[model samples]
Target: MKTLIVEDSATLCAIYSQYLDGSGLEVTSVETLADAKAALVDWHPHLVLLDIELPDGNGLDLLNETVNLSSPPAVVVMTGHGEAHAEQAIQLGAADFLTKPFDASRLRVTLLNAAEKLTLSQQVETLAVKREYLGPLMGSSSAMQSVYETVESLAGTLATAFIMGESGTGKELAARAIHQLSARAPGPFIVVDCASLATDQLERALFGTDGEVAQGLVAQAAEGTLFLDEVCSLGFASQATLLRLIQHGTYRPVGSAAEATADVRIIASTNRDPLFEMREGRLREDLYYRLHVVPLRMPAMRERSDDILMLAKDFLDRIAHEEEKDAHNLSDPGAQALRGYSWPGNVRQLENTMRQLLLTSTSTEIDESAIHQVISVNEISVGNAMRSRPSQLAESAMEPSTIQPLWMTEKKTIEEAIAACDGSINRAAQYLEVAPSTIYRKLQSWKAQNLNV
Candidate 1:
């Protein structure tokens, strides 16, 4: 944990420093907003103990600046008895406030609790950034067989790969196959969705911010693959930073002055044509060539129509077992209907159709009626997309949806735990092996909806 104290009184800074001494946290003190901002450039602290009044300006102005950061540090404001700005400080995202003259113990406790929340939030975000590569590639088409052969050949090489494919073409599965067959299989296989991030959050998501050096995908994939999905959606700055990591194997974190070496291999994927991306100013020319080594293009399902029945049968078998249905194989008309329809969504669409068929059927074989109910057999049947909610499908496929909002389940479970622990929030958190602050935060959020413990 690290803290930066912003105060004009040198004597108070000394007192705070002594109180934090030998507490296993690094502390830095600044007397003005300018010095505090300068320290933030290189010294990214996890928490800030800010004073309401600084020699140069008011600290709330500084709070406004920091609050707009992508990964802002926690702020704890200090105000005098009559000059307390508690409500304003809270509105500006001050984690906690202290009315002067607060004892050193109170300051230490408040900062420590805020530090715990900050650290836990970072950990959750880091865990959410990773993707688990669990299975082998699932096609046996001639085109797919060729892709697998190429993957086998490049499995041991350390060179970067650029995976090219349209959406739903299993580009990510191909990336996983390469990783699992390579020497770095034992390490992590991390994914960063370039298009999903806002420009302000992209740098920190990839390279981390000033204080969170190890929170980026690159660091998390230390000896493994950092798969950049839709790589061209990345901003110019992120692309340049990625190019630096590839060219020099070093990158500077978002606000850090120093550069660190990266050992992760880059595997970038994009649905757009690489040439078109570079020509339109979305992808840089220099970076494209560096990532263009060992290109692997995934074949769209439309190009391999012969594999449609095989893929559908495989999906049916899995879905049958999962749903405990009697469906075992497709009838002749069922197979013809599947092969004739143009799959605009590719293999993913076929798999989803199979699952729906399996859910709707109770017979040993899938009939033509069940197939036509979900998939349109006529050429002009447009706008009736197949990816409907599972529970909201045709009457035959009335199985309960297995997917539900995770937070609802979590809220129910936590509320039950609190009741089981005799309404002791701390005891409930301890039973769940989580920090008490997590429950408190969730409860506070739920209170807005008139939820009671």
Candidate 2:
């Protein structure tokens, strides 16, 4: 601890030096209030031991300044007269007060206690500052810095933002971060999965159905954020409805005569290129401009090679805790392998792989073999995706000889990928270029059919 002693009497100051001797604290002494103020301007001691009777001014004056300063130091006031001022000093933000003719034995213990409190207080302040930048997010790389800057800029506004990134690059996380930081953080944040919304029922889901007025996600999300995930998948009719919603603050549900006002902040995300969507007429150009008011492009995992192990280790530790496993971290070789291998599926794939390792590998440290196994599975998926010729699955699906349900073909292909990956659904999902949820839902449907998945 850094302590400043403000005492005018030279003999008393010497006595204080003797009491504080060998206490492992850096001590500085000043005799007058003017010198004390000068020292305070730059010294910024953690604890100030002040004598009320100073040469030029009362120690209470300096105490008041210390209390009101932006980053104030702890104060312990002393007086040669009486102990009555102790109560008054504490009410003015002094940590504690002491009378002159101080007890030498008690002085050491008093300073030590104050030092401990100062240390803990500084630690809490530091944690609060760090959390403002990285509470839900991890990794302190430059790639993440840019994202943080954009998040900060958009957090206080009501602009409709579009977060663009590859699948599993944490687009939803970015959207949630914006909502959590915004002024509307306390209000509801509803996510409408545009890709999953049925075309025939999207209007009802967003605006509302006929009977129930509050059936719409937008109406429910009033005064908060409405997140549209995979918005590029929305059909033209849905796109037109959404454009109208953005252009005007009012939206009328299906079969409703009155138009209800919905004050909502829109945040949308898509893995597909938004420009391509506009060019192909999938996404309305006017709606694109509205959402493009604030554009956030998340850096892919491979692009942020600096954050690979950081993210990997974080996932490992969390998985270990949840599963009650003793595996604490990744080995140096494992970390190196992770950085070297190209992550075709980004953060989500890495997280899923870590979960798999914690569940399957008994070794405390995730070794290089586990890393290679996961990467090799992803590599196979990329190879298969690349080898599929132009028109991709369309060319094969239209074969007259097959004459089978398209879903059966898709199920067979997905199952083969899972079997090939030795029953790892995450790796299979990566190979099939779909969300893990899609794979899980498909397996559930197959299970209902009494068919092996």
lDDT of 2 by residue, 230-266 (tens): 9888876677678888889778888988888888999
Off by over 4 Å in 2: 1-133, 381-453
Which segments of model 1 are wrong by more than 4 Å?
Answer: 1-135, 377-453
- Model 1: lDDT to the true structure: 0.81
Candidate 1's residue-wise lDDT over 1-453, tens digit each?
A: 779999999999999988887667789899999998887767877799999888889899889888887888989898884534888899888988888887878877888888888889889897555322224676656677678767776677988888998888888888888899999999999998988987667778878877898998788999999888998777766676678889998878888998888988788899889877664445777888998988888898888787888788878888878887775898899889888877888888888888877776678788778888887642234443433434343656645585446667778989999999999997887666454666776777778777543
Task: Kindly provide the TM-score of model 1 when superposed on the true structure, using C-alpha atoms.
Answer: 0.53
Deviation in angstroms for 448 in model 1?
65
Candidate 2 TM-score versus the reference: 0.59
Report the poorest 10 consecutive residues by lDDT, candidate 1: 378-387
- List of clashing residue pairs for candidate 1: none
- State which candidate has the highest TM-score: 2
User: How high is the CA lDDT of each candidate model?
Assistant: 0.81, 0.82
